[model samples]
Target: MEVETINVQEAILLESTTLSSRQKNEMNVMKTKYGKTMENSDYLEKLEFFVIDVIKTKQMDTLLTLNRTDGNVPRWFVTGFIRMPGFLYAICQLPRRYRYTNCINLFIDSCEILGMICDDVAGSRLSKVDFNTQSDEHWTLFVQFIGVIYREGNSAGFKTKLIRTLRLINYREGEYTSFVQALFKAHSRIVVLRIDFEYQKGIARTVSLSEALDDLDHLVANMRNNAMFDHMLGYIFKVEYGVDRGIHIHSVLFFNGARRNGANHIGHAKQIGDYWQNKITLGRGTYWNVNAKIEQYRQKGICGIGPIHWQEYDLQVNLLNMVIHYVCKEQQMIRSDAEPYRKIIRKQHFPKINEVRRGRPRTIMIASVSDQLEVESI
Candidate 1:
């Protein structure tokens, strides 16, 4: 069966069409065979944007020209290429009736071409086989190429390693939850605010990466002195980079809920953002108040913002799983261990809780009599 080559928009529209009875039956059969359908819509959507960007910008040739000798390849390019196989597998798992055939074919073709380039660079016959027929061998070569790119220090290995560590923590279900739980233990309720700090348009290009990082550090240092954050309990910040935004920080601020009682989180976020723009960056920076889009997140059923009580288990889970992951997703992917990037920053010390006696204290005479009686029995 031949698959038609169509634009992403057209393919998406086709995918949305109501399925016929036969198509539905086939989809059911596929689901049963695959054990369970993989719900990777988010990943697939991002992959779609990547595909469109590569095709529209004609970056395929530059991506295919993998030079083993030249050490100038962009880290983003290598990481993005290495992620193609995973994307391909995601597409393949979709039922045939709803799959974007054109996108899958493009990935398959690119993988083959890039695999051949890897073979040439490695001076091996690893890429001589076809991925469609011999997927095991293809995957073996792909894993080998990962080591090749990691040694060159232009791959996603470091970021992947960090994410894996995070995943391990998340799996244990303690680290992030414990942090939040400790905050709640000290305070009756805590307000969570997410703020993104970025440079103004074209301003990032003017300043060097190190300068941008220094500015963030200074801003965070001054946050303690800022009147707005006087009641702040804790904070977490992650650094990331992009072509347009350059270097930026995604920060989550935890405030004493009692102190911020009846306060508008969105307005508070805006005030902090304005301070970052007007004071810290001196009019050269801007910010996004994530709390401003609270309604949208609520609509998406992933609402993890606003004030939360200690008993709000579901909201805490969302904050730990979704909010934290989103903040840490793109952090510190451009650098390596030699000049380590400060990917995440947090408070050095947490608030200590003083132990208080739960019941009335006994008099000194009574306490001494009880101790003497116990010693005599022994």
Candidate 2:
């Protein structure tokens, strides 16, 4: 597939009316609040110092805290980074809650762009940074670092894109909810599975984003015809480009729960994952069995995988809110030069209306009492 690379700077300037008046007003309020507090010179100076310190000491966690409210960074500043070319990619590499040092290398690379750290120093700063310790000063400077990146990266353009991107995210979320509802209506129960298809670290660095996407598209097309997916009900796939992971896909597969007969959902997921790894991509790809980690999600109270009955309202809600929403979120953030409304999420195999049978038609019977009375009169 020929993938078009969007020029981030140019795309941000495109006009969009996706946000409602209320949303626009709210954004204006947020911008005004932050604008009054920090000047460009101060923001840049703080950012430079913060980057230099983090580079020298390798304190990456201080950078992570900028996303939190207690970190003292403005909300707009944090949100603005979402539109930065590779910011989301780096953020995705970080472990949840920033508990570990997964993306320190990427962080350093991003910092290098600011010209705050010398090229020679960046290579030596690859050691792990302790996420558990942070001083008050670090927090203050980290906020400045975040604010500077936004301000220097063209704050006005980022804000415009942020508004448009948020509106697109909301609209896509609604579509996801509706899609899930339709699946439930068509089938009494669905065996939901989540699988992540990604390239090996070395392979990821070797291929272009478009090439990766093409390989994934081919794999998915073949899977549809494969016997393993014979009873498939529906599926959704999302392509994301990350700094570390490169081009990858987050996918959800829906199958006929009755046919599965409450079988090992994780096992089924493994088969698909293995197919992507060994057969489809021919060892160039690796897959993560998201269902295998069900317990983790369960502990967090967001487990939405496994066989879910249509009548089970809570499970259905969880599936829609947690699973579906996740796959559909950040769709607007896809770095594509094609068009503003290009669809990054691919959905297919939905049950047709006529194919679905809902609780067999109710039987009706009428007594002929009037006929009996007429016979007696005769």
Best by TM-score: 2
Q: Which residue pairs does candidate 2 place in steric collision?
A: none
Top model number, lDDT: 2
Residue 58 deviation, candidate 2, in Å?
Answer: 30
Worst lDDT 10-window in candidate 1: 369-378
Q: What lDDT tens digits, residue by residue, belong to model 2 across residues 1-378?
A: 332233322332331245566544543443343232212222222333333333333333444544333333322333233222223222333222111111232244445554434322322222121111123443354455554543433346544644565565566666656667767767777899999898997766455545666777777679757887868878888876543465678899889898885468998899888988898788989988999998898888887889888777767778877888777665212344433233447777744623647575422121111211111100
lDDT (Cα, tens digit) per residue for candidate 1, span 1-378: 332223323332343366566544544443343444333344455564554444343333443444333344443343334344335444443322111223333443454555542223322112233332114454345444333433322225534644554554343234334555566555666889999988886666345445666777787788767788867877776665443455677888888787895258888899899999998889999998999998898898787888877567667667877886565443222332333535333432235532343444322111111111111100
Evaluated at residue 302, the lDDT of candidate 2 is 84
